[model samples]
Target: MSALTVSQEEVKRLKGIGFLNNKGTDDFSARIVTVNGKVSASQHRLMADAAEKFGNGMLAYTTRLSVEVQGIPYEKVEEFQKFIAQEGLTTGGTGAKVRPIVSCKGTTCQYGLLDSYALSEKIFHRFYEGYRDVELPHKFKIAVGGCPNNCVKPNLNDVGIIGQRIPVVDAEKCKGCKKCAMEAACPNGFAKVVDGKIHIDTENCRHCGRCVGKCPFHTTDESIYGYKIYIGGRWGKKVSRGRALDIIFTSEDETLDMIEKILLFYKENGKKGERFAETIERIRFENVERQLLPSC
Candidate 1:
């Protein structure tokens, strides 16, 4: 990749303001960039104001549902952070080991089972410690979702959390209406209408909750079963989607703990600059899974 061209005129202008590099400031201190997302209009505006105060007013958005404000100099970083804190935001994920985790809200959908906001906040707060400075062999991405709508694309991240549901049919109330069957609610074609009666093929059903959504009488239930963990997915350079590690129980806090374990394991055992996928390919999936989930 080509080196960034530092505008001499811009540098001179900044230096003239006495804010470029103060006494004792590291000459090579990296520039600070701020970011937020499409949230409450108020927060979005607050982030924009922060960019005006701390950066060069250049903003960039990512597909992962975030915005980046760039061109911040070194000396004013502390002041910039203080200013952002007033807006109730922070910038730990912009630099390294773990980036800001992306997730979708459960409030907007009936299919959603877990609280995504709580999950996002918990992951963000807990994972920030030690991750900012820790170097990764390659950039890692994490995405979580509340259901099988694939909102976060579970199969396409270094780590992913996907929601699942197992539906229970009340045959007495079902009336064999076949409403669920007609909607094609089951991706596996598990539901069928025969003899004017709705029959569910349990063996083929993935229990994705669509049938429940379509049926008025059949009740829907969040599967006690946890999320399906995926490993080794990435997009850039060596693009590859992660494969399923295993089905884990849905404990948000515990899941984060497991993620930390995986990250640490990768750091200790992976070759320098090897991504999670590359590492998995080298060490073998079973060994990686054993390290990630020893009990199962």
Candidate 2:
């Protein structure tokens, strides 16, 4: 803290590599990259050792799921990086590229329909690491949620992927029971028996899959799993709720490709210093959607 030795320019350069300057001190925090907020037990232990060895002996967690070793002097940055590197860890998640991928614990949760952890792993390897060098108009953030629970706040990111389970009814198997189990199981009352047939209000059904296989007659016995994508969502000083694409991607490949296409669109058409939401607004969501969606 006595006499700043590191110049402002040098600090900016360090930030590009995931080192954040500590206020009122020459110390910096090294942000270690993490995928879906998960790391091996050995990785965690190595970070703990690095925190005490080169940092202030304390570690901080970022909202994006990266770990930070706080209080490392400017000179010890390289040493800290190397120490964690032995465990195959690295420091990054800054700049105008894809930020860290976030995954909710939806896959393990009772309501979860998708494997949030696995999907996020694909995103991290495919985009976060794959697009590491591809600069965009601004930082791009991605989040994967396992279900409609929105535990990860996917709608708040630039690109959000949420899992969905749409119930498929076998009308021939339905028996319009006097006391319908599907009706009782449906949290939203979207399922009902009318005139010897079970009807699902497509407009109101949340596709939560809770009612699937609930009917005694096996009427609602099957379901379709899909991913709902939202684009152009932003949060902070200015907030923009992402718009859901018209189609529900039944294949993971389509969802992943959609993400890449959106990134490409932004990279080519977006203006410098503008967020993806702003770009979408400028170009008009209607036009953007038409180009991105396969049907259009």
Candidate 3:
């Protein structure tokens, strides 16, 4: 007998949440509550209590420092959210708007280069309210990374912000010990000993900024500023990958401007219900870039 291959739908058991309607309506009627920043043990207790009281006692942690409450009927969503607000939480990630922006766990860990929490705050303060009620063709996801380790997988998001620093090597000062290559734990094997000299494979290295910390002789450089942006990526039914939008070296204002420009371009040119990736696919990458990034 052959083993059965379970279908994804069967495995998911979508109707288990009871959000589905009787006539076959989409399961987009659920409301969520988001509580970010320093999460306390007390918060967990409250969440559990509230879930059992008002919700299904089921909580789902989102990638963007929020939680979802499924199974709430359409009529009771507002009331559920109101009850949740009393417990210091409010509805978020509900509707076709900019969801909570998130960043990798940075600063708390040794591997982190930038302050993720602070950056997330910046994004929220700048654009969150503006997008609260605005409708769009599809859901959008954005993530920021402090380094090239890709904790947020910037290459796979609609808009990805990754910290980057140009490495400057001092060849004359280098002893050719190859410690950076041999001992350092680089996933891409960027550093290597060529002709008894330490050679950094720029292409292979993810520019994760780890090598800068691992180098014994302090050969790695970290003076450069700015981020690399990617656009038009998503992971749902129509899986698509984004491409490098640009290598921008400027203030946070510039980065946000670029993102808004791309979004606006998509809104103007894209068909109804078409996502950023779909628009990109419909129009060639070059044309899209040319229209969006005229300065590039």
**Model 3 ranges off by over 4 Å:** 1-30, 35-44, 63-65, 71-76, 178-185, 195-197, 213-216, 248-250
TM-score of 2: 0.95
Sorting all predicted structures by TM-score, with the top scorer first, yields 2, 3, 1
* Residues 1-296, model 2: lDDT tens digits: 65567899999999999999997778999999998899999999999999989988898999899999999999899988889999999999999999999999987898899989999999999999999999899999999999887888899999999998999999999877889898998888889888988899997677788888888778877899999999999899999999888888999998999999999999998999999999999999999999898476
Winner by lDDT: 2
Candidates arranged by lDDT, highest first: 2, 1, 3
Residue range with the least summed lDDT across 10 consecutive positions in model 3: 18-27
Give the 10-residue window scoring lowest on summed lDDT in candidate 1: 27-36
Tens-place lDDT per residue, model 3, 1-296, is 22324334632343322223323322222334342344567666766666676556687676666765554444554466566566566555644456667677765756665676677667665555566556667666677777767777766777778776555666565667845443365566776767766677876555665555455666554445557788887776777877876455447778778777776676577787777888888898888888777766
The regions of model 1 sitting more than 4 angstroms off are 1-43, 53-58, 71-79, 92-96, 169-184, 193-206, 213-225
Per-residue lDDT tens digits of candidate 1, residues 1-296? 23435455744544432224322333312222222133566666876786777666665666565565565655565676677666565544443366667777654677686676666667655654447667887666777777767777766878877766656655555565636543476766777876766677765565466766466654433235456667888876568878776655566667888878888888888787778888998998888888788875
Stronger candidate by TM-score (1 vs 2): 2
TM-scores of all predicted structures: 0.72, 0.95, 0.77
lDDT of 2 at 14: 96
